[model samples]
Target: MKVKQKSICETCRKQKIPCDGTKPSCSQCRLRDLCCPGYQSDWIFVPHTAQSDRHSGATVVSQSGIVGGRKRIKDPRPNPKYQGARELTVPRVLGLSVSHLMTLIIRSYVPEPELASLDSNSNGANTYSQPRICGCWVEVLPNLIAKGETVALSSAVRAFAVSILSGGPMPIASLASGLEAYSVALRSLQRALRSACQFRDELAAAIMCILLAELLLPTTLNSWAAHLQGFGELMQLSGPELYTSGIGHKLFVGARPSLVILGFLSRKASFLGTDEWRCLPFGLQPPSAMQQLLSEAAVIPSILERLDKASGLPPRDRAIVDRESLHDFVAVLGRLGQWETYLQSADQYPLSWVKADAEEGAISCRWFNNITDANVLTHFWAFKVICLQNIDELAGNHPGMTSSSQFSTSFRERVGLSVMISQSIGYLMQDEMKLFGPSSVIMPLRTAYDTFRAGSSQCKVELRQCNEIISGILERGYHFVPLFFEAFRDAQFCPMSV
Candidate 1:
């Protein structure tokens, strides 16, 4: 017969106690304490066989609990809520990984003296930290301002380096791809990317785009590398400094010309003009006024006429005019009798070319010296007047009441246009400056500033309308993040797109 073996209580085996083995704890320990000693820390004990957990070599977890009996092991199964988490990894760029390329970029850009932050954070302590934007780990906006208070040259260089290492070079139409990659790469390292995502985030875009634009500009330059770097520099300025208020108009701000050109290029790329220009309906094309004039109730007739003709077309087909179309239209009138000359060579055209010539003309008596072209100025005014009229009377907001006469009418808008006409017309009279300059022919400013001015009639009527557009953009921006982390959580793997 087999030798009789004593029952080994799990509690006694776990606690190293002498056991007159019973069902749960040792009969001695339980009777004396009225509780099994190790059973109080039941999470640590494997039940059933007294020796079951001994061979596994896994440490037990102890939770505070009082147990009197040998309850079965409390094995709970995992639910769907706890399953299938995505693995985040450092994004790879080109052939090299993000970590490696960033090392290369930091190494290259750090060599510049104007860029001093390069060496200060050089210690391996915080070697690869990305700037905080907004929220949690996701996204890169080329806008730049969202990432930090000020754009530092070193950081700008680092971001550009990452963008280039990842995306190579991008056309103006698809610049966001590289930024997305930088966002992903940054998200996975040490910390999740985002402490703030706001209007400020545009700084990141501005910095990256400026760097990226530094690479793509100057079409005539045959050096591909030079072209790429040039475009990137322009993109970097899309930040609050250049893109913000009155300060953006400074001469030779570098990006001003390219942004003007980009507005043009983006306009050309959109088969349907959205932000830059509106189109006349095929059936109801406006021969008298290309765009509707301003009004309170009066302007509605023309707009309605245009809208009626356009309304029959699907909502998708309705053309909303924008900045580019206005500029292009201005260009058309500027070309005057020579309009065809510009059409074939729009791509080779940079705003700088036009501005440069205008400046030279003003400085030296050269092309377009005649200030007698009233027709060109008037046409320019017409485009602007119509643009202003469109800006007026958008009742998107209820900004209380005002005088009835204040209700903008096209005739009144023409009156408002007269204010701009006065301001711009005087520009041509500024010494011999216009003998060859841009502002010579009644001037070519990319503004309907008078129409938007607070004192102007259209601005009063359209203030709420403009604010609604601004607010709408803000509200829409809030949805940048998705509910499912998996959707953008994968950005860590592919930095080019978050």
Candidate 2:
């Protein structure tokens, strides 16, 4: 029998070069003046199979000399390091992986400064330590989802992030996935609430997350109302105790804008008017001038609600209601004037109105010249406009309301104020669309757009500019911008006489 040739040295075989089968040293190695790497008895040459066979979804020897097959099953046991980790059974949605999805969600929801803080803090003593409550949903929650814990909340968070990523009008499949995730999250939340689970904070955070997802869904009005109401109730249930913690306080403050918007939309004062809600921290003492201004501004929504309810009464009843409301309206005007005076006097938050020539008209505008604090200025002016809008509504709609020259002058002044604020916002938004994302000033911009006199050519031009900025926001994946745009269009067609 012919003797089988000895296998080539391991190094030569690995290098895919011919190796003369020598016991002490291969000819290839000796010729190269290199140490002979020892050979294995089991070494054998194996050529790659046909492409068709390679992709048949079966095991094969890979190019790297390892046996390749379908993905291996992950171990079911919880990691000792991650005590509560659960393996997710629900398959990840196609296209993006879990880690990628988590990254996108974190970037979209978490503020840049807060994220930077998290990054800096990550290198501390415990690398795997849990982040604050504000971060828990975006950071720790993803890991929990990967381990298959809190599926509902995770699904909702994922759906919201995916919806945002899809931008514009979402694809049908993506919409379906979002809806399904939302459904799962809602049901899971209910179950957790009913059960005796120890993790109340997690559940509370989930409720907030679900609320965020609902907002992204651009859900029906009733659905949005329900989510807001549910969140309000959940926050109440958590009580004042929740606000005592640093994370809790941060979350509470962050949620204030949503609460204000929801309160305005629902025409409900109880959301913000409640003693419990008011007891929550507004700011550290001595409060910033901006904080003081916001605190006073927050009361305007309730006043508007009162005016709205009064407007719905019969002429006779409305006259009585209007008389009572007139006092409140005058009081509000006084308060607003006082705030404006305070804003003017406070050196800390200095504001000045500069006259500028616009294409449509000459307008007096107040904006923060400081680029960094422009958003604060936007909120300040926006709140002022909102207060003025309510005052205008109350003054114009009440049956007993006098059209006296005094009232007319007040009304004219209010109109001028609204115009100035709207134009200023338009200019600011135009300049800072990239700096402050579309959603940052969308509500206030929408309010300003709607409140501006529809018939004025100047107002119309300013409104068009605002719409362009909103459209830009829409192009950047804020689908909800269009809804507001549509509402503005409706307001234009059927202008609110009030």
Candidate 3:
């Protein structure tokens, strides 16, 4: 028979408060408004004694030594006053305070030079412990901090980190520290922006930091949009040439996904759609399959813009405009088709890059070689869905322009793409993928969820999986996802034009 171990929640236990044992959440924790890390009986306290230590044969204790300006006892075991002494329980997370942890995380970034051998030596490596933005922020920010380039970046990064680690409604202390750092970062950012020539790169990085923080702890609905606008302006100021190499290239690449989403949402043409912007950022480096995909996706906004313009025209003029838009849409669709074909035909995407797994129950999932590959695949599916939606919409609005067979084909493809997304959720929601995987899939998952008919069996199943993924995201400190989750939840259809 298993022994029933009684225990209080970790928070209450840490605080040394009396806990009225409860399931899910204890009364004390609920009263304090803390995100209580649930109950566990993993700890065992034993009175510190030579006899007990000898029996355990694990810990070695010195009989006498001066510690913290006090002469140690020869043997506290023999003293009645020290009879109740016990070993201190070490915290699972190594750090006395949030500030200390932040310092450790900031200092722990592996610069590019140091990370060189990682690829060769990374077999069975536990990369989960490394910082999330390894090649981008992790590579650049630490070096900048060391050189005293900017203090605000460091504080902003810390605030963002704290928000992620806390996982849910932050404790009072964690919230205070995060807000304090955030305030300091904002004030410093104001000064830096005023002197843009001196702190151009720093200004861009600082804005990114604010955007990241706003994702999880948003001040208002427009806060992220406002900050994103600033980032885009910074990009314009920096120009494509500036990002041709080094730290500039990394920053540009890091900021591209957000910029792409912004372009689509705004339904306006952007510089990202231009050939110069696509080719220049890579410089001497060969663009990855992901980069190539982004290049194709950037043109989507221009298509949306054309479609928007066509809608405002008179019927006769609209028909002419529709013909031009339809041609562009088909061209983009062909390009995406070629992209998919290239991935299969190219030597870069090895067979080992993706793995297929059997579904244990309701959740069917596939695993990828890494987070980047997973991101690329999900986004690919989403982009295809959007493109198809646009193509069908354009075709449908002007009758006889597009064949009925084309609509049937597009419908079939959309259904298949949604299934692919639903299956991939299992791997994407894993704890190890939290840093990059979860946030990257929000839009794709939303797109996938929208592909199905409402109240149908397929739609209900997809909705459940999406909800589970969103819950996992929130539980892992991606509080920003839920805000978007609510907005997408009730929507009957995706506004592809919007």
Report the lDDT tens digits of candidate 3 across residue range 174-292: 34434445666777778767766743565666677667655555354366766786677668766788887666666677677788877776787878888889998877766667778
Q: Check candidate 2 and list the clashing pairs.
A: 86-147, 86-148, 87-147
* Tens-digit lDDT track of model 2 for 306-413: 767876778889767666766665675577678767756755545545545444443335555442244445556566555555555556765346555555565455
TM-score of 1: 0.21
Q: Against the true structure, what is each candidate's TM-score?
A: 0.21, 0.62, 0.70
- Residue clash pairs of candidate 3: none
lDDT of each: 0.30, 0.51, 0.59
Segments of candidate 3 deviating more than 4 angstroms: 1-135, 165-173, 348-361, 453-460, 475-477, 486-498
Query: lDDT tens digits, residues 431-451, model 1?
Result: 322111221221122223334
Global local distance difference test of model 2: 0.51
Worst 10 residues of 2 by lDDT: 59-68
TM-score of 2: 0.62
Candidates sorted by lDDT, descending order? Answer: 3, 2, 1
Candidate with top TM-score is 3
